[model samples]
Each structure stands twice: as structure tokens, then as C-alpha cells.
Target: MKTAVEKAADTDYRELSVSPHLITEAKSALMHFERLCGRYQQMYNTQVQANKLFVVKAKNARMYISHFVQVLYMSIQRTEIKEEHLSLYGLEECNMIVPDISTNEQLLEWGRKIIEGENIRISRGAVPIYNPSIAKVKVMYTLFKEGYQTQKLHQKATTRVQDEVAAYREKVDKLILDIWEEVEKDNMDLATDQRLDRNRQYGVIYYYRKGERV
Candidate 1:
């Protein structure tokens, strides 16, 4: 009733003899490749030359992954179980396959979320949005968590600094007023002493120095 290819398509790769580690590595590589593609779209010509080697590596890794998947799929097809047969599928074709969030729909959603997300600043020249990593959601989650905490700490520090500056300015103003009062009092005393000396010279009065009369 069903062709071999169709039956193969329905097989569950999880039930097969595939190595979970290799599958995890393949998924990570695919996500990394997609992220690179997003970055490549925004790169300048200068970066193209500098990133040539990375590009080559991504391409080779992609090819290796494709080849490995095919081999693994074929090897797994050799043995069949009574319940569910295991088969390999592309990154997006099956439930367990990682989704390429680099797609237009996913990217648009990410951009909207970033616009609404707290403490996220988009520079005029900065990349519009972060590209989503597929299988490496754990990595993205860690980075975003760290970034959010760091931003909150920075805001708290800035607020404290502002309060300290305001208090310092008030203290400085009070000190200045006190110094001015002292200076004015000293000047008035000196002027009164000069006037008394003139008056005494004209025989108008007697005067006393701070402790002893003269």
C-alpha cells in the first residue's frame, strides 16, 4: 500500500540506532549556519574578504552534515522494529527537527519582540534585531538573561551616581555660603578698625587692640 520512500518518511529517527550526540552536533551546526547567513546579509564588503575562511568552513560543515545525515539515515533503515521505524528528516520538516528562526516569519516576530522588550536599545546603525539560533536556544537564553541583568545593574548604578552628585552639589553650595559670610565679617571688622584709627588720630576717641590698649 505504501512506497518505500513514503514509509521511510513516516519512520521516527528516534527509534533508530542514531547517536544522540551526533544529532545534537548536527542541529547546532545547522543553527550556527543560519545565524551566519543572517550576519552575512548585513556584512560590508571589507568583512567579506576577512570572513572568507569562515564562509568556507560553514559551507564545508553544511556539506558534511548533509552527507552524514544521508549515511546515518540509510544505516538506520537497515534494521526495523515492530512498533515505530526511525528515519531522518530535514531541520524543519519534522517536530523534533530544529526550526530555522531565520525565516521571515520568525525574524519578524523576533523584531517585534525586541521592540517591545525592556532595557533593549537599538542604535541607529546597529543591527535591527538579533537572529534566532535554532538548536542553541539555550545559548541565546543565557546571553539574553545576562544582558538583561547587566542593564538593570547599570541603571541602578547611574541612579545612585546622580543622587550622590546632587547631595555633593548641595554641600558645596552651603560651604560656599559659609565662606562668603566669614569673608564679609572679616572685611567689616577691618573697615571699622581703619575708621577708628582715623578718628583717634583726630583726638576723637581712645582705642584698644584685641587684648592691650595703645
Candidate 2:
């Protein structure tokens, strides 16, 4: 449970015999690693926001299309078409007798395509630096490992810092990967809903249980 700052202090030269040059190098490397962590966090936030917006817009578009087709189906059910109603509803092209079942099926097909397109877009829109950041963290971690291996003085202090750096890198890499995994899972769920009636509607519902928290 050692904090990252505490681990950094461990390598900041506790031994009187440790050279100032080595201490300076270690401090500088740690600072750079922290800065990279900040950048990675910012990148992650941006990507999450982008993903949310993309999904929301897609849902809105699908809703609009579904509603439009529903309206068209309802209009076609009329026994006689009126001139005023025709102009008001703009039902010129939709004047023909279109079955409700066929209309719903077309809407479902459109929804599937929308989801498929979104999956492709999400796959292509992944942050370019995501993987490279993990690689950079691994490289930065090697500095501490090498220092720990060669240190003549404060061996225990160096070891603590080296292990901490490794842990930090692993944590960061896992976080980035987890975010990517969530996005992929979301897209997969959308694509898989093609067979379900939920896709034709507004997707799966989260019904309220009696005691469940909102």
C-alpha cells in the first residue's frame, strides 16, 4: 500500500554515500513518468467523452428513423387519403399500401446497419497513442529496474522504488486496456441485438426492482 510519492522518496537517496548525480537522475525520470501519467489520463477522458457522444447520436438517429417509419405505417392504414392530410403529413411517396410488418422489418434492418457502422467507426476511432503510452511506460520502468540492480548503497530503498514503478506501469496499462475493452463490449452488444426485438425498439430495458437503488 505504499503511495507512489512515498516510493519516489525511497529512491531519492536516503544513504549519505549515494551520489547526488544518481539521485538527480532518478528524480528527473520519476517526474517525466508522472507527467506521462497525466497525459494518459487526459487522453482517456477525451476518448470516453467521444465514445459517449457517438453512441448518443447514433441512438437519437435510430429513434428518429423508427418514429418516422411508424408514422408512415399509421398513415397507410387510413381507408381514404385526404388532400389536407396529405400536404400536412407529406404523405405523397407513402400513399401506397405498405404493411406494418414489412415496415417494422425494414426499420430493424436499418437499425442493424446503423449499429454495424458504429462498430466500424469505433474500431477505427481508437486513440493512436493508447498502445504507445503503454510501451513508453514499460521503457520508463526499466530505468528504475536497472538502477535497483546496480545500486551499491540503499539497496532496499532502490528495490522498493523499482517494484513500485513496475506496479504503477502495470496499473496504468491495465486501465487503458480496460477502457478499450468496455468500448468493444458495448459495440459487440449493439451488433448482437439484431435478432432481438429490443433492437427494433429502444434496446434492452433495465426494469426497476422494488428495493433497487436508482
Best by TM-score: 2
Task: For candidate 2, write residues 1-214 as lDDT tens digits.
Answer: 1122233355434421224443344445557568665655555555556555444444444445445434434534653223333323233444543223223335344444423432343366632122223233333333333332333234444455555667677655544344334334434454444423322221222356899873
- What would you estimate as the lDDT of candidate 2? 0.40
In model 2, which residue pairs have backbone atoms overlapping below 3 Å?
Answer: none
After superposition, the stretches of candidate 1 with alpha carbons farther than 4 Å from their true spots are 1-133, 188-214
- Against the true structure, what is each candidate's TM-score? 0.27, 0.30
**What C-alpha lDDT do the candidate models reach, one value each?**
0.37, 0.40
Please provide, for model 1 over 1-214, each residue's C-alpha lDDT reduced to its tens digit, 9 standing for 90 to 100: 0121122234465532223343344344435444554444434333445345444433433333334334333433554211122221222233333233333344333323323321122232322222232223333333444444444455565555555555555544443344334334333444667745533332234446888854
**Candidate 2 positional error at 102, Å:** 20
Global fold similarity of model 1 (TM-score): 0.27
User: What RMSD does model 2 have?
Assistant: 28.5
